[model samples]
Target: MEFLQLKYFQTAARYEHITKAAEELRIAQPSLSKTIARLEEDLGVQLFDRQGRNIQLNACGRAFLEHVNRAFMELDNGIKKVKDLAGMKKVSISIAMTLPKILPKLLSPFLNQYPHVHFRQIMEPPSILKRKLEDGEIDLCISPVPFGSPAIEWKPLFTDDIYLIVPTDHYLAGRKSIHISEIKNESFILMNTGFSIRDLVDKLFNEAGFTPEIIMEVNDPETIIGMIRRGKGVTFISKRDWQYVSHLIPEKIRINDPNWHQMIGLSWSTKKDLSIEAYHFKQYVIEFFEKT
Candidate 1:
């Protein structure tokens, strides 16, 4: 099979629409289709299921797409490595994170050391970040916890306490700390379901034996903090996040539950080739936490 055939098949699999994929690749729809057909024939498996004009990845296609993505990613990494070795290094590291606000502080030391380094940051939920890391779309991810993938290598950073935040005028605001069971009936403005903190909050509520009365689910931490300042609802905040806007929300009550804290860490692909820049950044992160 030709390399172009694999590339065409991957583009089609990504869009799952032959015409749209062709448009994106700047190729004719029929040519793209024939290329994919030839690839399927060579592989002896149907990559997609066609429903008239629409198409979807079949089981085999999904499996094949995984390998194709990694193959392209490795090829890209190889080119970058050669460029770095030739002293034409202009490294760009792609990163996805749940707590993006913390990244500036975390990366400052590394950036100070390597002024030539650049980053592409994607602030996404933990689930999506994990998927991107697994798919080799991003070089690394910073999240509360590691995903259970053999291809992923998780290095523990540091743990932080989770606070039950409320407005100063709220009824529970006077208390030094509160139990998870205490907040069962209160309205909550939490992060949306994809976040690691959201998962933790849901699990805490489940253990407390009642579902929270969620008023709104937000993606941004600043929005959640804003709502809390206006006495809208209560939500959990990591110690790191709370530090940034502590003056805005003074009622940072600790969660009395022992397991209420989160362990944030760096996760990278064990299978993908790590560029020199990514390798240095990973080491810097691990050592930074150690010094702290």
Candidate 2:
């Protein structure tokens, strides 16, 4: 029988008296009896034994009631789970990130406040991250906005100046300040081409009228720091990223003259619709970094 019929049967079976069931359900006694009869016919089973004006459930009716009760209980549990998820008692967040330092500083605070929210993180370049946002692979991106796609929207989170990172005992490490042009002759550790910070470095070198002595290329800021650690080559990174290299921070950092600041932002797809949870999380990130 259908849910409605099962429901009517459940009520009638609970009372075990058609007259009382009809009164509780606001229906006529004959109508309730007819519905129950129709239900019994559909299931090909006799549900009750009638004795004058009273009723008692048959053995088959007792067994069916047990299963119906279980089914309704499961349905109720499933609905509760959906409600809890909507209320954020159970939540998930997906982010595309480019740098390690900024992510921990931003993510730690959120996780502390919401330990229940499941976190999913992916490290990707700006181009791939942008594509992920469009395809709904990532809910948000803490990355640079790529050129030529106005469909991406960015909320300026922070702008950090780039600093020259030299080996601890290197000559430039002792400098009070240096010019970008002076570093032209030194070997360099560059980020991969699609990264936005690389574009900034290239522009600075172009303006200084020299090519960097390209030594190595790596995807992440940490790898670039690793390269610098081995004296593979010097590199540039935002002040935010440089802080994470605490052991090397002592003498390796020197701000170049005419300090250039690249803006880091929280980016999401402008063309795609944002869910309430994603929208709230994005807003939280903006306000969180805005304080710093």
Candidate 3:
């Protein structure tokens, strides 16, 4: 019914979980629930089907979501245009990425050059990041895998090698490299389902004709490495991770397949025209990768 109510509805609908949406919106779960209920009542239709603690958007909700998304996007663009005209703080760029640690390296120099520029970083799985990018929730994204969306454009940054890592005390620690089939029965720790690396690892296992014996699904790479160090299991990591973790001396088992690597890159929506500052920042990232 109101502008803020639409925002609340959009957040709740995006996640399809009231509590999770509330947490993201920085509001109480009851408050979010009440807001959604008021919105549904105002529209005189059931937007979401309530099932215990979970919720799913129905057909009506889905249709309304598209309109709401576009409306907000236009409003944001107008506001950004006004800010640019006013020359207030060059621009505010919201970027989503799978790796939070890389933000400093990517933004530090650029921010130094344009002191008026501001940045908002969102660290999320590639799947969610893709959705946010499409919805115009973020200006651009850096991802390890392609989103496969026609509305989005992706540019290859670099090829990052994937490695199979094991605890130093594990039996396979002595091996320089190994096939996925060799570790079929070994316990494993992996990034949770939505992460691009997890998807690739799962596909690799499927191609090898075996399922990894997963023992833990976590969100943090550092924690996964810690678990592997304690002999909890093993996982596939990238060269970037290996750099941070080399001191641990975990055995890096290269996958036998030559193509067992991910193409890390930048992605942005083509639907919306970029502001001048955003365009320049995007080019900076492109050139930065080109030089590397």
Candidate 4:
């Protein structure tokens, strides 16, 4: 029933280990256990299923945890609002993105103008970014793919054409444009499955009625480019990213299909009220894209 009890329960549910949660909470294990027990007694439901030292959140616990999260979020929002009104807190913006390489260009100028503002940038896969936005964990998300949730609003920032990259000495490197089907037999160095680019490229391959021979799967763009430069395999890259790697002088051939481009967008949760700083940054992002 107490705020502290709910906090303890939320932490315990997160880790599913009483000792670990107690350690994080900086409280004694026995005291934390007693607090959770009192909370369960007050609620008249068993929150966690226990097996010796192991603990699992039951269905009731999961349901209650959702409300507990919202309660904490509301409390945090209220505090932030009060501090903003009094001009007592520094401006802070938290953003999650799948494309972290684009941050320097966007953030540098914005920070130059508002030097006092603090930014927390996180790099996550598109799926995890969507969850983070919905959970009120991030103020905004910039991604190549839309979250497609009713509670989230997505605004297209820009679209970049995808190109097939290969070593300069490769036979196909002489081509200006090529259909995806023509390269089905070529070895591919691709991003891992969870990445947005990987999903987009996979869909393109699926639609083209061919599965590419992927010889390597990597998480870093630099590594993919390096492999392609070494004639290890071919891969895809966006036109926006081409500028960064063009100096390496790899062959960048355009995909013949018109739909091969990727749309990058900005997204925010409609269910959560944006902080003043977040609102300004959102508008700044929109304007930044417009001017570009």
Listed per candidate, the RMSD to the true structure in angstroms reads 13.9, 10.4, 17.3, 13.3
Give the clashing residue pairs of candidate 3, or none. none
lDDT agreement of model 2 with the native:
0.77
Judge candidate 1 at residue 139 and give its lDDT.
94
Report the C-alpha lDDT of model 4 over 1-292, residue by residue, as the tens digit.
Answer: 8999999999999999988998999999989999999999999999999986579999999999999999999999888776764557677789987666678998999877666678999777778888888988889988787878988899999998899888989989779998777888999999999888899999988888888899999878889888877889888888878877788856889888768988989999998888876887899999988888
- Candidate 2 lDDT at 140 equals 82
Tell me which residue pairs clash in candidate 2: none
The TM-score, computed over Cα atoms with residue i paired to residue i, of candidate 2 is: 0.67
Candidate 4: pairs in clash: none
Tens digits of per-residue lDDT for model 1, 195-214:
89999878877877798899
Better of 2 and 3 by lDDT: 3
Candidate with better TM-score, 1 vs 3: 1
Writing each residue's lDDT as its tens digit, candidate 2 over 152-221 gives 7777777778888788767787786687767779999898887778878888788778888887887767
The lDDT for every candidate, in the order shown, is 0.85, 0.77, 0.85, 0.87
Considering summed lDDT, which 10 consecutive residues are worst modelled in model 4?
81-90
**Candidate number of the best lDDT:** 4
Q: How accurate is candidate 1 locally (lDDT)?
A: 0.85
TM-score of 1: 0.70
Model 4 misses residue 113 by how many Å? Answer: 1.9
